[model samples]
Target chain A: MCVLCGGFVVQEHWTEGRGSTGAASVTVGGGASRERQRDRRDRTAMANRILACYGLKLEDWNGSKYIVRDVKGSSEIVHDLGALWPAVEKLIKKTADPLDPALIGRLQQQQQQQQSGRP
Target chain B: MAANVKIPVIILSGFLGSGKTSLLTRALKQPQLANSAIIVNEFGRMGLDHHLLSRVEERTLLVGGGCVCCSMREDLVNACMELLEDMQRGAKPRVDRIIVETTGLADPSPIWFTVLRHPVLQHHFHVESVLVTVDAVNGMLHLDSHDESIKQISAADRVIVTKTDIADGEEIERLRRRIGQLNPAAEVELTDSEDTKSARFFADNPDSVRSPRTRCAMAAADGGREGRSAEDGRNGSGGHTDATHSVSIRFDRPLDWHAFGLWLSMLLHARGTDILRVKGLLDLGGEGPVSLNGVQHIIHPPEHLDGWPDGRRTSTIVFIMKKVQPQQVTSSLLAFQHMLGAVPYVLETDLQFPY
Candidate 1:
């Protein structure tokens, strides 16, 4: 389960759809098109916000494949919900900066300065 | 001011099997690009062909049938700087232009940012344009299923549709229309077509590429649409829900730069990941026109032009975003402008009336 959104936890190798190997197979469930749309929007928003924390973006394509692109590097296609975490982890490991901790602090300081109307 | 004599750097990007290598191979045969340097970024460990490599020196290799090609051994800045260093040390031939061909799955924006932000590189080089190659046979499918393809198309200054001979004419036409909808300002040309010669790809000046005629056509297209001024609302029906789209905004009068800057910074901060590319020419009051370029979270420092490229002085901004609505961007910008106490001279009614 997602801690922030209480969404269903993704299972490993959970292939549930067809068309194109390595395409994401996770489907959004529930009745009514409006509800389904709303659910998807909410889920995407949540996923995007969480992914930003790790410097990744989740792009859904063809309602079948989830492309996780590194904001600073390459991208990987996630075929199932279970595979998403591992892909993201691999990307983070591949692109992580050694000075990330200091970089985050510097960024926070800059944001605070900007908010306070300082140069 | 002497540093202003910068070599134009063109970015060549495309998805895997989009024929970028083939296009480059053909283009290098031209006399215009003979003295040019190429930085090739290949993904994975497999290297380029051995026959294509003719050992010119340790740092630079002369391709058998083409111009100088250097495999990008490090980050873009380092690679470019190394080339410059080689030139300074008289170890490399004098080159007029540089071309950086990114990996198939790479995003072009970061490379653009690197060129713009690096002090040494920016002094010696300028980003001329972003050229993207799309495979005509598999482009529609790739555009529908790959966000990378969408971003590449959106970020392109020129979209080259390759493999047209193999694909059906109807499929090619459909792909062309989709490209137009995604980036009305992009100059789309078929690779196999007679008009789109290899030498002419990056031959024109940047200002000429985004000419007034292209902007007028884009304005006309957006004007023909209903219920929106900047948005292209193409529904994502069928099985695809997250459709990549573009929004073009035009202002009749000059805008307050401070207000526009704030609004853009906020938008990028909030949804930079979704925004594949943002390119615009802004009319700052009393300051002439300035050009803005951004990709993902990185925004290049604005470049100020001496005067307008064409007769029209209108400010035009094109945003290529994924999953972000046009209304959201327009409304936010309008709201910010209002909060900043900057009243736009032209009204929505004026846009409709056109007189």
Candidate 2:
């Protein structure tokens, strides 16, 4: 059990390609504070792109957990990026498929926009 | 099992009648694997294979009546947990390795899931390798017919071709070629009765899997080229209707581990079944590159290598896939890698949901 968030999260989450762990519980250990925070923020940002596909928004909560909320106000407290997808699915009732033509198109377009200095 | 202690697990899979039992029996007799336990899983109402290898006695547990991949997945987990419990309680002798011999029809992915996904099992056990057996006589026919056989071959770290005495030389050659086309990274060998004993294979490898060597072999298959599909010169891709191809991608810049993990996790979540295996030597701007490997949805924790094998700063990743579009992987990975050092201040709201 993690003293930080009360669950066995992360490290395990980082290895999970299945993208489904459960509930809200993240623990930060090792590494310098700045580097760790930056990784967390980057992870959250990458997740926002996928979650937005399902009308869900993700935010880092106190650096220990994440808050995932849908446009409809239905929300879930996710433990880490690994646990975010299922929470997004539960909130929007659909698979947040990365290979979905729609999602890929958006990610590609977003990359293009970022490249072209477009907001 | 303690929190940090890990045990090695070898998943032995083969098509029905591929001589898995005979090989396992011979393996148990060897000194290298003598202190090993077996968990034999068989499909159907009863399992008789466990009785055949009764030499291991209490160490051999029979998980019967259902496939390890589907129906009796929990039973497989229980069997593993029970092995740990038995050893801990002194009911059974402690062993160095656990070999889960799946029924011929079982897919190794779910068995991997049963170990990796279980909270206790994940911490207590680590899958060392997937060893698949292919009998030379019908192996080609099975690969030409069965998807399970194809998956077993694709997931293999080592392939043991059995019954060489009965199988003609030419037939064995074809089987070997097909196995290569299916998985170029797999180390294929004949069950020559001396090779397994000599190499000290599954039982002896207590170290992490050398995915770098596997990647090097995969790259070498394409003549050491990058971005080319390894699908050419292969007839029909080992009975798969679609081209089961491998694509090698190179990155000139360093990879941000966090971002790379995120992209891969998302990709695996949706397309894991189609994407069979991935091996990469990632350049994290460190003195050495870290190795990343995945079989379907289960990506093993990355291991850092001493240094680049080729001494190149450019990171190399190879993907061996079945039915998945290479563009799906390439485009997404490149897009994510672009943000390695760029400020991620841009929010999701900034990009229009074009889809």
Candidate 3:
């Protein structure tokens, strides 16, 4: 347990919904669509940051792997959003067990506001 | 270009008033260095050396942020990338190698570590050698009085005694012995004619062969892993921030880039003096890992690389600063994460950002 942040491990919403249902319903509770969307937004943001550093424009490609052409030679740096998004989602789920629906809903609202350039 | 051609980096280091610039001026005249790229860091008010060396006015990369490796390592790397890109774009004589000249009062560790730790650099370029020059006229006095001078000697792969034409033979011999005692592995070369050949200096070493200095560096990296956690954040011995120290910041998930950009700009602006260098592999929302770097006030845009060399989830940012609190820097960074609703491990509040 990290003394810095209280030992409180915030469970993933899916994990909490099921974990509370006892042993019989443990594996049945999958999370709402809200948590998954948050994961995707976070992953996409990560991708954009990576592309920006490489001198590549995000609007250049239609959301697929691209090649990073440098002066030395042209090397390929592929960004497969399909593969990365899921992994980030999995990591979010594992670190926090028994996730909060209210937090997920707030995060979704934040995401929409971000997409709309509101806040 | 098909079969991977490794990039070669040549380090030029020396003490104050030493013949480092003089030697570089001499080396640039050589036919071998005709197509090479030079990275220079500035510490003094006047930057006459850049003007002096660019007699050809071809392509001279002025790394004015701070000390290379410590404060300007990322800038050095970015400069190298730009140079490489220029070479590919049919700009010059098609140069592949790079020569980095450190400031007179600079430590060689950060530069050395930058070369060692960079993933792209390791794949593209290998550190050919660390060549340090000692001034024959005031060499002994500088070595005796300056800790920076001692470090320059200690980390040398090759030691060149300059201005031998004017100095007494006995005095030159004494200086040679002192350098040898500090580091016996480095081969000592004496030159007064300024006719040192670039081919002769960096030729045999190549990237394949491992020299004594490289071996020591490898040993230091391995044996010093324990100290890395502590030293990574500690400030350096220099009263002015040393660029070699790095601050590592890890994120649990991808961060909000806008917040990150704001935080970075704020950090760089507030502590520009202390922050000599910044570089990291960032997890862009949906993208893999993007590498970001900044030197002094200039964050050289950004470079979206091919992919992580390995599947490392955690995002790491290293800051080489002087006389700054690592905890404060870390907390400031954490505040950015907290704004994004990410909880980070608050390592230590008073952790030294020593390099």
The runs of at least 3 residues in candidate 3 whose Cα sits more than 4 Å from the true structure, single-residue gaps closed, are A1-119, B1-4, B43-72, B90-93, B194-199, B202-355
The TM-score measured for candidate 2 stands at 0.75
Q: Which candidate has the top score in DockQ?
A: 2
lDDT of 3 by residue, A22-72 (tens): 112223345545554454355445444433323332221333333333334
Docking class of 2: incorrect
Runs in model 2 deviating more than 4 A are A1-11, A15-35, A49-56, A70-74, A90-94, A101-105, B1-5, B42-72, B91-93, B168-170, B193-199, B205-239, B310-314, B340-355
Model 3's TM-score against the true structure = 0.40
Q: Which 10-residue window in model 1 chain B sums to the lowest lDDT?
A: B62-71
Q: Candidate 2 lDDT, tens digit per residue, B1-355? A: 3212467778889999997877877676667776776777543323234322222211222132122221226666677788888888999777777787878887776666566656677777877678899998888888878888888887787788988888889888767766665666567778754445722555554453443244443342332332212343344354453456655566657766666766666566556567777766666677766666667756666655565655665566667777776665555654455555322211111011222
lDDT order of candidates, top first? 2, 1, 3
User: How accurate locally is residue B276 in candidate 2, as Cα lDDT from 0 to 100?
Assistant: 79
lDDT agreement of model 1 with the native: 0.57
Per-model RMSD to reference: 18.3, 8.2, 17.1
Candidate 3 residue A115 C-alpha distance from true site, Å: 69
lDDT of 2 by residue, A62-91 (tens): 988889998877778977655665566667
Residue range B291-339, candidate 1, lDDT tens digits: 6666665555565554554456767777777777665555445433432
Q: Candidate 3 on B103-170: residue-level lDDT in tens?
A: 78877656654654454554566565678889988877776577677667655667888889999998
